[model samples]
Target: MMGESNRTTEIPCEFYSDKYPDPSNHPITIVLFTLLYTFVFLISFAGNMGVIYATIRHRSLQTVQNIFIVNLAISGVILACLSIPLTPVTHIAKQWFFGSLLCRVVGGTQAIGTFIGTFSLCAIAVDRYFRLVIAPGRPLRKVNAMRITMIMWAVSIVVTLPYVYHMNLMKYSPKHGLCGWFCTEKWPSPFSKRAYTIFVLVIQFLIPFSIMTVCYHAIFSFLRKRAKTRLTSIAQQANLLYVLAATAGRETQQHKEQMTHLLDQKKRVVAQKRRVTLILVSMVFIFGITSLPHNFVSTLMEFTDSRDLLTFYKTDYTYIVSLLTHLVGNEPDTTVAPFASLQPLHSFVNRYHSAVIPCANFETVFIWYINEYSGQFSSLAMLSCVTNPLLYAFLNPEFRELVLNGLAGVSWANNFVSKSWHPTQTTVL
Candidate 1:
């Protein structure tokens, strides 16, 4: 028993046992997580596939911007198919059932998807900025967009190779378990891990995020200035028409009507432009917000030692108080030992030792905290896959129309099936 308990204390935080309840194992949690993952998968897969299908079927939809949109959709589809489904399973089961090859494949695919998505967003922003602000009449060519997308894919794959190389499936024994397995990166050294984490964080997230922010900010500024100038010009034209109305009666009235129509058209154009800009800005904002938590946690884990974090958590009196309240309650039962009022405190210490101390050394506590809590945040990051389709494809008027039309056309198959199953009656009755 002593040997078993000692071994249990030595077990890594990644594996769970009876002493540490696996929250993911709860019936309610399992149901909710399953539902959420399924919802994200279906939406992402169907939405992105629709975008790709629409672009392929209709040549008109194959513009430069649509090209990048298609790329983004491809990335979303990849993540939906590969990453999201398996992620929750690993967390819930506290094991990696997939073998060594799949561990690398899945990890590589996820990294590729993330990089492609981020790069595509940046590319779209830069393309839009150039089209609107740099040269209004000269838009990016479809060929150029295709080249850019291919470059993004190549770069994403190249950068992700290192991660795939480091990824490994290793087996371990959890408390009360014969054997368990997990998939994780086993870097050559601490410095290598830190370097890779920093590299990925900066290249995949920070740089692309910075680029998108700058481009979109400039685009918004340009649109606002352009709208103001156009509105001013329209007002001036209206005043001129009003002034000329007195000199030439019938002809001036006709001219004023034309000016009114033109003014309305300009207003509509400005409003449309503002809406598009707002949607694009929201996409960037959402991307940053969703991705930040994952990146921050990764960086913290890489750069900071677990011992440091444990020390901080331990020394922070507020944290201790909150933890105690959470573990015990606001008040303890003095009646448990009437003669020894400190019995409750002693019990609390014993419970803490049995529950936490044995299962959680400083490093174990830190890893457990991350595995338990940060996994929730990681789900938020995956949710960006679902949001990409909504923000980039479904929300865009042209893309939405094309997708709807394509879906409407798919009813032919249903019609044929219905005809075959239930023959129509065309009698005079």
Candidate 2:
């Protein structure tokens, strides 16, 4: 039903006819997907948990930016725990086994996490811009950061309510007479569905992307301008010192030492500014790359008819050829009967067996292939959860120290962390 139709009316489970078996059902595919999902879960969960634990355990790590990072880590943990585990199962089974209550809860939780993460990123960008550009050296207060975090959660929850309400568990009987259930959105009308889709696209992607872009651009420009001015002033001072030394006929050791110190200081300042800019830019770029694909697919699905989508994919020679080759080579027996071992349903099977035969056609296979891969692409958005923690660990040295110190109770980890510890340098940017 998910990939087959976009209409509000109930569709029969024949929409998922076994004739067009899901590609994800292949044994190798299932195993690979399982491993991938497991890795994502472990990394995202453990990494984000570490961030949260460090922030809570160490007052020194509880800065304004780290507050937003903690919020993001919380969202990542939610996604890893609630969403990633169910993704592969749903794709392979092409059904929702977790009933109606879970359907609503999981759907709502996903939306809330997405909203909170997006908002937190924007908040971080704004905080950085204000600290660096608007009021240099004055960081946001922890109390205000806490208030902003609360507001973000509240707004995210409110915006996700309608989406949760529309998450329906639809049950229908396939031609094989077996009842199947799937969780999907059941909007009152097509207009409402499109409206909500557009609303989410705007709130989740457009506004936040624009905000990050503008804020980061302004911050970069400000830093570049300030750095250029400082460098020019330093160069002038060096020239004046050189003239003085030449006129005096001898350069004093103190003057040479002072010149060298100023140059070193300028280099450090420039390097620090560049590092900060690069980290923020990388964060913004990764967010866009991971978010755009899922949003684009959603837009296409909502705006175009299923038949149109099928037709579009049908025209793709590569997908059709590859799908055919894979099915033909891997699945030699395409005519395998549906639920062949269920002897109790023999009469029912005989009655409607012919109904299931039509689905073996080319169009059904193409549709299944398209939907399977689209769902796979949509899952890529979850990579943001993985990437966020990794970025923090690698780019933010102070946070990394906090995480390592938190793990210092373990023998091997403590040895490694102690060897790497350098508290005097403060490489936070």
Give per-residue lDDT, candidate 1, residue 407.
85
lDDT, residue 423, model 2 = 34
* Model 1 TM: 0.73
Judge candidate 2 at residue 360 and give its lDDT.
45
Model 1 RMSD in angstroms: 13.4
Clashing pairs in 2: none
The per-residue C-alpha lDDT of model 2 at residue 361 equals 44
| Candidate 2, position 239, lDDT | 89
The sequence of per-residue lDDT tens digits that candidate 1 reaches over residues 93-150 is: 5456778777677667766777787888889888877987788789988888888998
187: Cα error in model 2, Å: 1.1
Q: Write the residue-wise lDDT of candidate 2 on 183-220 in tens digits.
A: 55545665765676677778877899999999988877
- Local accuracy by lDDT, each model: 0.57, 0.60
